[model samples]
Target: MAKVAVLGAGSWGTALSIVLADNQHEVRLWTHRTEQAKKINQTRRNDQYLDAVIPEAITAYSDLKQAIAGVTAVVFVVPTKAIREVARQVDPLISPETTIIHASKGIEPVTLKRVSQMIGEELTAFKEEEIVVLSGPSHAEEVALRQPTTVTVSSVDPDRARLTQDLFINESFRVYTSPDVLGIELGGALKNIIALGAGISDGLGYGDNAKAALMTRGLAEIARLGTSLGANPLSFLGLPGVGDLIVTCTSVHSRNWRAGNLLGKGNKLEDVLEQMGMVVEGVRTVKAAYQFAKEQQVEMPITEGIYQVLFEGKQPKDVVGQLMSRNKRQEMDDLAQLLMERYSQ
Candidate 1:
């Protein structure tokens, strides 16, 4: 088994450390807080993020240098907002040969860069080909419970992508390799916006019909934007795209959905975020996505609605009414046109 360093000790990071340990890999889980790392090392239980008993092979580290010492691979599961800061620190410590894997899902709000792009900008020690992205529908909570979970690893380097697949695959955890890194990143990041919409629909007393419409249409918009940016449109139809969309929009463990639910229940945005106590990526992604969609000339009504509700103080009911009252077009015709346009290129 190889030694792996997982940066970030949040729920997702903690859960991923558990998976690495289960696979017999020595894992150094890093958190900035010395007390938390010491506590995790002593207790073997990260009660704040997960209740699962951590395996003995997994140790927590407060020092970044110590955590990354001589590791074969480094998995970054930090929030999108923190990706740059973490990558800067890791840049000097990371070996050029070390495979950098990021599981965080979100676009940088100000720059509109994907997680991989941000890491690429900061981690000059690593080549772009050395970066891999692990993304799909697998929630941290269920994965920690040893539930059956599957994800896709994508990279410009096919060999490295396959290596990432091998690193994470096990009996309960299935991994696939893909060359469409942009699609994987876009799908994983954009789906959180739809998940928030789904939660908002639920919180507003809307039925499944509302959520289903929101999810599917929201997906169409995301695909449109992703394709415009040179991502494989078909990639979105697979794990990172449709699969992640389903899980995030429907799953109870989605923090983005929970945040939206609180917003729909008339809580202030600040209050919703404060109550979540987790990085609701959708909140930040919506801002960047909204700006990007406009720049790309892609029509994303669902994203716009969520953006307005969160940032413009538009009520949930008002947005829903506006969405329903919009001029109509054939759904299949639009989808077919998009597919044709993408495939023709």
Candidate 2:
């Protein structure tokens, strides 16, 4: 019965808190908003973000230090934009021995740093190998309902990864361990870009054929970039890779997909964001990825197209046409090039 602190009061954080509580761990769910914390404690529910009741073993706290005190593990479930601030706050309060785990998935725009990288940058007390990432195709809504969901945990240290796996695994929520931290994080982050593209395709009334093509080619693009960044190419075919892409692109629960759908239906980016009232991670990730790909000289036409539509004022239909009109190439060129590079490395 370890004491765990889950930062952020969003759906994912709350659901994960429920999981810990269910497993007989004492859970401290921290939200920045005092009202939210009080409400959850009073009603045992987080009505705004989650539909299910929070467990009795889970306690909500607005004080960051109080929530983290004596906890053996601290799970970060905040947004990418908020990670640094939260980490800075946590650095002074948390013990160096507390295991750090982050479940957020997105790349920082200017820095192009993954969520784990951002946390590591802020929390100097812990070694890089101590950081763990929890990611996969699981959605908070379904997980809250105790529906079967599987996810992967990865770290530079195999022991740390397995420790994190043990912290979250159960019959309904299966956890797997992997050594390819770079591949897992990259796959989880980059898949959102493709999900947005998929939503746009659907919103534009494109049939199954177009979406299927987009998903397949999007996986190729993700694998291409992941391999360039020292990730194992085969990891792209796993749960955090192809599995995540499929779910985010196809599910209505995806904020990124919903945002892209609105854009495809002719809404402006600002209006779409305002209407959604949630952080559509894909929007920011597309921008960061566009710059990163340019720097690395990687080919990512689908991501480029989405970037243009979201930031450059290009019409969604026009971007689609541009993508289709690109010069033809062999299907396996990307894979072959990546494999050659991998072997040479």
TM-score of each: 0.98, 0.97
Q: What tens-digit string does per-residue lDDT give for candidate 2 at 145-252?
A: 999999999999887888888889998999999999899999999999999999999899998999999999999999988888889998888999999999999999
Which 10 successive residues of model 1 have the least lDDT summed? 333-342
lDDT score at residue 289, model 1, on the 0-100 scale: 97
What global local distance difference test value does model 1 have?
0.91
lDDT tens digits by residue: candidate 1, 1-345: 989999999999998898899899999999998999999999998888877898999999999999999999999999988999999998899778898899999999878999988899999887666689999989889999999999999999988898888888998889999999988999999999999999999889899998999988988888888988988888888998999999998878999888888888889999999888878999999999999999999889999999999999999999999999999888875455778876798
Itemize residue pairs with steric clashes in candidate 1.
none
Best by lDDT: 2
